[model samples]
Target chain A: MSNQKLFHVAVVGATGAVGEQIIRLLETRDFPIEKLTLLSSERSAGTKLTFKGNDITVKAATPDSFKGVDIALFSAGGGVSLELIPHAISHGAVCIDNTSAYRMDPDTPLVVPEVNIDRINEHKGVIANPNCSTIQMVAALKPLYDRYGISRIIVSTYQAVSGAGSRAIDEMLRQSKEILAGNTVEPQILPVGALPVKHQIAFNAIPQIDKFTENGFTYEEMKMINETKKILGDDSLEVTATCVRIPVVYGHSESVYVEMKQDFDLEEVKQLLADAPGIVLQDNPAEQQYPLAADAAGKLETFVGRVRRDLSNPRGLNMWIVSDNLLKGAAWNAVQIAEYIAIEQK
Target chain B: MSNQKLFHVAVVGATGAVGEQIIRLLETRDFPIEKLTLLSSERSAGTKLTFKGNDITVKAATPDSFKGVDIALFSAGGGVSLELIPHAISHGAVCIDNTSAYRMDPDTPLVVPEVNIDRINEHKGVIANPNCSTIQMVAALKPLYDRYGISRIIVSTYQAVSGAGSRAIDEMLRQSKEILAGNTVEPQILPVGALPVKHQIAFNAIPQIDKFTENGFTYEEMKMINETKKILGDDSLEVTATCVRIPVVYGHSESVYVEMKQDFDLEEVKQLLADAPGIVLQDNPAEQQYPLAADAAGKLETFVGRVRRDLSNPRGLNMWIVSDNLLKGAAWNAVQIAEYIAIEQK
Candidate 1:
């Protein structure tokens, strides 16, 4: 602790799609890093990456690997998180898990920093990053919820293929070329990669983002529905999600419908969102301006646009939210949670 | 009919995205034709188009140009249809308008053949083509509405930019290349062209499509909300629409949350969708296969997947609906209705 300043950050799943973005974001945001340890599965171990001119070799991630880490950020699959998070906690590492493994765990704190920074202090060594689609949504909704007291939420997501993983992104590129060349291409990863059914995502929309749970909601949909309630800290809030995957490589966009507890004006609602943390107001209708994935692809801001009242429900508002699924949705979200932990422990 | 003979159809929007495909569909379906008359805006007029080994010259569309034309199919634009439709209808011809200008006119029949083919007979002069987003949705819901009365429909569309026009498709391609090359590109011609706002659609999602109306709904969203109610002939059915423009070029996918008058069994709903005309079932979760835009891009079928009952609401069902926006949503729908008009009148 003598002159060895700043936090020692360990990034698991370092070679993954979101993991790579997390690396870039860390560099761009100038996250405090005393020692950066990169880790991945055994198959991906030994990969070399240069971060801030330091070549860091990816080590095989084992439970014991987290020994001296101060903060562990994870974008690995839920399986990896379920296995390694305890290792992280045991080694005194505050784990920010960017997977569904502990998102709904009653014992764990699911967080979007701008919305629920206070909740991070209650974390018992583990903080859950929400579904990529859910993160941007809650980031945008928190300000509205704080001011308007949202009674219910209904969101339909336009997600990208990269959220499925690196292989899915590759498959999208491969199939897109094949379709352009007028060649027959087999779909490998999409909707869910491990599922027996495959689908083309090069120039199309896929209505399902994750595997369906027995309760009839796809795991992705449930993540948004449950995470919204958790992040917003309103368990009684009525939330529903219909998640769909589009061909974009990054950014998860959502059409979020909300019912407020009190009457409000559209101008006031826009003002609240504009002032909200992590939110960028792109809602000037006269200019035909709003958020789009292409614009939000590399950015960290959650874009909100097309704010208006619901015709059927006067108290309800509908908005379009778009953010880079890899950044704001996954990697950046995990990093922010880690930062939140740091800020709170201070 | 004078000679008791049908005229060959020349699709003017040919060689263009919708035009090229309409040509292929017309040939595949074997639409009755004795001679084809291809017409386009002056910029594209006089271009030689090949159809079934026949070279057709695309003449400039004019009000005096519909002479002897029995059926004129249009998907060019509102201006083209507005200028040429009266001429077509006045000269013993039927015009199928695939534009916004005539859709809300009380006299025009907004026809989705599967849903309201009979309405074609009531056309005073022209038949209106519904929005690409509206067409597939109403087609899928029609069968359900027929089997069990629908009470409400809350649809959030993940639409492709190809619906905005050829220039938008070009812009998406242009913007993607620029982003991949690490260049910042500005957006133009999305949400609404007339509005001051234009956004990058390359890797983004824009919630505002079309202009805002008096009630806060964009023209695109209002089209879906209004058109759905009108097509279903049920003013009482609650409909809320949030239309978004994504980077996709061909398909318009929807995350439709529907409330029915009766509770439905999962298997029974599958059977109904299977039996429904023009609808394809792709909802096998075990295989991870479902309807996707890339797969639906070149195909002329509406796909339904992720069929599941809402856990909390007994009457609510959440499903994914996807189809090529160019085909079932716009161009092909117009052509199909035109074919039906040719046949049913005989």
Candidate 2:
């Protein structure tokens, strides 16, 4: 490793779920940062943050906030990223965005390092991190796509409330207690927060994740459908997604069924995934071993298990995908891409 | 209408989630039960249960407990059903079982009333209630199955922990409090009870519902696959299931992708579901309408929404199915089958 001097980094929306993850990941991964900046909305600004034993002050993210910053990581919201990310880029700083605003743009190199690290060099000012559901999926699918030529993917996500934001997580907890106490609690954070309608999430499974499209798929569903195709670089591959928010906190688990163009034995598929980057294989059945959200939370790797061939379809395979949504799905993935970009820039 | 008097009813496992729903259903629907029998395991026996201001004693279920029992509904377990159902059947009582011991048996009729209520008459001794996930699926698919014969089905479930039993629900609550308090607590009841392993169901998801079959599907998953065909009276429809446990306590949701044997218009399919038995449609998109677990919990109807066509195949349709697992998925469905059998026997 070349001893290149480190660059200073700032993370906007520093107190949110994904933002807090970016902070923990920076310390654990030993990201080479000479200094760190913590920024949030005005309400959260001025809060003191402890990072690597040093307290850092958080400031409001404004247009003039990125003069000396070399790189800015964003996960606040689509609106915040839309307003502040370009301003950060225009101020001589490269941005890695973890929102949908820039992901579909042809110019932005939407990246998952394990899937396509080389695409980092193609960044056009702003790099996009694909949806959390898409990132884990394509990471798990890429090795198989390269080896078996995946022609189709059908994914149904069991998502966590933390994915909606910090308040959504709080709503789930508050409502759980209220439900057990035999009190009625109103929901305020799910099925599109701005829609003026709230549904209780306690002891419930809601099929709608984001606002609906005229075609009937929710925005979260469409993001996974389109982002997977864009990241895998296979426009012809069929992708269908159903995104649902369950009463989970950290990890998002998906049941993925894929039909490969080339047929392969189940052992071969397991072996290939076992050797893939950023993937952990926990497929031993004798021990009742498999991936679980409790074990996967706070971890960066995508866990794949319960892998098998579809009983009725000759070319189909079924598997379970689990990853900590806050970490790998959002903050960790954004940071991982930044690391790859930093190494190449060096 | 003839003046035939309706028989008395008994709800086994009356103190549990399903039992509560069964009680409410019998009262609300005004099913003509001359007497209501409330039975439970010996540990919970002797408690006084009040229904519509009438008090009843919770009796311990034993092999000889079926004497003079008109209809005994069993939601206790497969072990309890296996032991007591034969005795109930021999004593001129119709047994409606809500466990897996007899679902796939050749002589037993696995009934989802919307699909094949006629199958109830075919029950030789015990009538099996289809798995909760399977129940919602076939209910939504029955209309589509009749109009356009279904060739295949791929389903991924976002299941509630209450599907496991009451102890799992308690574990979820206890663990959530422990997590919110920032403490470490060992998990005791999730995924499966017989397995020594445990997982935190609070803010998490477990992919393996039951023990894995040699074919890679969990026993819960296999239940969905096998029971769907049997309940629909056709073993030829290709079906696959992936069962997952989320933090939700009451309702089970499914993302079902169906390939119709014949062509289907999206609106026609939605209309068919609207007219189908026991299904409630909430598919208006401009107003942001759809099914939610919070809305369906404690309600007996199966909720269907998010009806749309698949992006890649004109013959394929994707829909979301939601229902309170304790009600339609477990307790009420069993009671309804018992009601059907009582009517058919007369």
Candidate 3:
């Protein structure tokens, strides 16, 4: 134990969903920490949370909150990350952001540890975590891409309501109850974006996950397309995505079809996926076993199944990918990078 | 109105979800029905349903039930269809079967009215309605396929609970209430297939919709693949599908990507869809206008939106297609065929 060097860590947005998960993971993983500071917005600063049998009072995050902090995790929102990430980096803290603020920034390496751990060394001060939907997809695709060159990708997402936030989870639960009780439901917080018109997601699927871009793709879909390319470090690869938010509370499921540049053996592809870093292969169809959103609620690994070669395109492969949006998608991913940095420091 | 010929119509599975919708559409459309007979299994027999301000008793469907029946709509289980359809045909009743029993039969013409209405003439005895998932997809793709010549198609579905039947609807509603009340839910009816395993549909997505084939695709997915080919009368076209069941009570939403053999003009494709029959284009992304399951529920028209050309494959196009699974997908389509047959006879 004495050979391990402990570091001071600060968790921003410490009261939010992904932030709370990050704190829980830090405690459960027994990360080497000499001191832990929990930080949130002014509205939630005074709240207390127990970690390692100690009550830690969360403080309002500001530029000074990063003083002497070796690692800072940001997950409040994109705006908060843009405001506080620079301050944390200036204070000599390596920031692992869970927001999209710096994911596309060429300087801040977008790391999914299993896919691109070496890229962490190129991060100047910040390492951005990919979107929850993008993280699970690239993790499953990385091994396949390495084995057989991927030329194009098309994905359709069945995303959990929790990806919007805790409020959206509450909204879905509330709406479901209201509809079941024969009462009218007024939707308040789904499709979280700049749009004023809210759609009911209690028992429905909404195609727009985020605000629409100049092209027809929503911001969430664009994030998957761009973040995947950045993490894979190839801008020329073709990617298209349709992001839809379902009533699921925890896990995000994706139906991904990829066209490989070369023909490959199906058995080899299955073996490669079975041996991938943070992936669990659950592709037995006869027993009716596959990765489902319910079974993937709290797990940290990406669960992939239903792998088959496309009937039409011999070079195309299709698979279903599922993972907990808060874990592998956000919290655990950030922690993995932090662990890498700690090991490199030793 | 007097010049129109009246016919005796029999509705099988009259107590089920799609059966109820067929009766409602018949009443609303004021179809020329001289006598209406509601037929169900022995379990649902003696139940009474009102049509055109007249109460009709649902009787046990047998060989004698089709006596003097000019047109019959069958939505019962596949076993019942296989047993009763031959008897209905022998009695001179044109059967429009909504089950999968005879959809792939060489003599049975699979018909989606808007796409292949002329095929009704070639039906030897029964006209098979495509699967609920296949109906909406082919309806949206017909115009595009006609103009650009489709080479391949890949689709992922967000299906409704009601497609599994009325019991599945009750199960989903009950599960949602139990889950919202923080109680344990015992799922009994989702992914209704030969498998005994049931999955929770409340706030979760089940990737398997039907019994898995030897090739790892479910029967529902294979229906989408084979039905598209037969309905289009082109066996060489490539198609693949992933069918997922959500908690939605009505309406099935599809994320479809089609690779056209020829280059397409995006504006021209939009115009083609807009000008097509039984298709509604709601694709203004600037206003967050897109087809949603909630909006498409209980509507007869196939709602299409989010039409965009793929960024990676110039010849590939992506669109979101949605329709009430019981309406345009089943009941309304069957009724449309019946109306065409009546007109052709006159």
The candidate that achieves the highest DockQ relative to the unseen native structure:
3
Predicted model with the maximum lDDT: 3
- Kindly list the per-residue Cα lDDT of model 3 for residues B109-223, writing each as its tens digit: 9999999998899987799999999999999999999999999999999999999989899899889888787898988877774578888888888889989888778889899
User: Candidate 1 on B1-346: residue-level lDDT in tens?
Assistant: 5544466454545546677767777778777778778788889887897778888888877777777888878778777778778878889788887788799898888999989998988989788989889999999988889877898888898888888778888787777667656789887776566666566776566677777887768888899988888888888888889887777777888888888898677788889998898999888776666777767887878999878877657777888899999899877898888788877766
Cα lDDT of model 2 by residue, A1-346, tens digit: 4687687788988998889989989998888888898999999999998899999989999988888888899888889989988888788788999889899999989899998877887876789989999999999989899988999899998887888888888888898788777888877877678887777776677777888887888899899989998998889989888888777777888899999998888999999899999999998766777788778888989999989898889789999898998888999999998897678767
User: After superposition, which runs of candidate 2 have C-alpha atoms over 4 Å from their true positions?
Assistant: A1-3, A79-91, B6-24, B34-63, B67-70
**Candidate 2 C-alpha lDDT tens digits along B288-318:** 7788776788888999998888887888788
Ranking by lDDT: 3, 2, 1
lDDT of each: 0.81, 0.85, 0.92
lDDT of 3 by residue, A1-346 (tens): 5789999999999999999999999999999999999999999999999899999999999988999999999999999999998899999999999999999997999999999998999988899999999999999999999989999999999999999989999899889888887898888877764578788999999999988888788889999999999999999999999999998999999999999999989889999999999999999887778899989998999999999888778998989999999999999999999999989886
DockQ score, prediction 2: 0.64
- Scanning candidate 1 chain A in windows of ten residues, the lowest lDDT window is A337-346
- Calculate each model's fnat, 2 decimals: 0.66, 0.73, 0.77
